[model samples]
Target: MRLVKTEKTGRSVHWPTIAALAFLVPVLLTALGDAKGAEPEHRPLMSFEYDPSSEVDVELVLAVDISQSMDTDEQEVQRAGYIAALTSEEFLNAVQYGPTGRIAVIYMEWGGVDEHFLVADWTVIKDAATARIFAGQIAEAPLRQVQRTSITSALTKSVSLVNENAYQGLRRVIDISGDGPNNQGGSVTKVRDHLVSAGITINGLPLMMKTSTNTWQAMLNLDHYYEDCVIGGPGSFAIPVKSKDGFADAIRMKLVMEIAGLTFDRPSFHPVADRRPVRCDLFD
Candidate 1:
């Protein structure tokens, strides 16, 4: 059964969905069909065989949200944001000044539970040319929207992607952007802590341009939710996009910070074992 967070007290209450049998039958069938051999049973966090030649300054995973809540227009803007960020001068400069003068990146979009689409595979960006090629790949892919918000599943997939990629880096980061809270999967904080323990940093781009109408679409204090629940590890922080016009700029600044290892002045949201302000498992 799924647990939902009451808006007022932040207390979790469980509910059975058996009353919606007619509506859920097809969804369950579809989910089962989609899950067939989609992912491996076990994936190591890192490969034991490390190649000295494959080292880079950072391994960055861009986990974008493409849930139904993000309209097509917003999706276009989001896509444009990343494209611009990747090719921006600031981002290029950050890479150039890095210890290895290069970083490995992968772009992936997430929506429902276990649903993730890797738009761009791991590519080393040491200069503008390679950055443009990576951006072009993102620009070329057709935009898609899936149901639900599963940041938990997305982060899990990211770990697998990092493990499978043939690169070693001084830092590993998963930059996840979303407009809503986790409402369709396992506990997000559990996975966040796992990643942090494995020496991975997570940053957030919490899009707060629209108010939440339903549990699936958005939430109040999304920035706080991101801070208290989503992001973790050293130097991890969340940037809230309160307006559409700021997407490109926010994305560019975030990219530069992650690549350059620049620390934000804001407070770090690393999870404390006994004290959590936001219930990461508070789902819809």
Candidate 2:
């Protein structure tokens, strides 16, 4: 979907709200140390160096799957793909379009209700150097244990992050990348409905590498599941990567489309009429 260009002045940036207690409380507590009054170790403030004068267009949250279904090799491929995209020249070209065309990405791994960790939070990548650093950090971080796929919880959490931040962008999107169907927590459709109603877009990247003889059938089924249950908002679409080798290209393509706020002319990939059921192979 094309993002509507909106005028943004300094006053409209919500600096006061950004400085409010909700954001400041943690900083204050850390600076003051524990209740015993001992000096706490110093840490850098969580802020980005992007030029605010440039046009701001998109805020994206990447909710990645780390469920037990994805083995270590698969996890490595996923992580590497993102890192490569961050450093690619194509991504840099995408960032230069707007005055301050910045993409604030929050990298998170989600499985079960209790198994989401923020590997990277709200980092703005405006230049190639910064993007490379962010990618390196992501590459070095250890993959956490997976539990279950909770599409509803991940969507809810991503929406909250975007709402809390002050972004003068034309579009807000949640990019969910997973390899399995939702089998835990609340209904995925309900969450998608709520996010759609709030004018937020949800896109899906379903990984379909592990299916046996029915690989194509499994992908078709998974695509249908995502369309019916997880994707929403204007111009939302799902792009499936049939194998690990396809991950980098898929992500790069999606990023380009998203950063440009481009609309999809063709209909999104939907399931064929006679697809088979997704056996609970990952869960069992």
Reference-based TM-score of each model: 0.77, 0.74
lDDT of each: 0.89, 0.78
Total clashes in model 2, counting residue pairs 3 or more apart in sequence or in different chains: 4
Candidate 1 regions with alpha-carbon error over 4 angstroms = 1-52, 212-219, 268-276
Worst 10 residues of 1 by lDDT: 267-276
Winning model by lDDT: 1
TM-score of 1: 0.77
lDDT of 1 by residue, 207-226 (tens): 98785444533545687788
TM-score, model 2 to reference: 0.74
Which whole-number lDDT from 0 to 100 does residue 93 have in model 1? Answer: 95
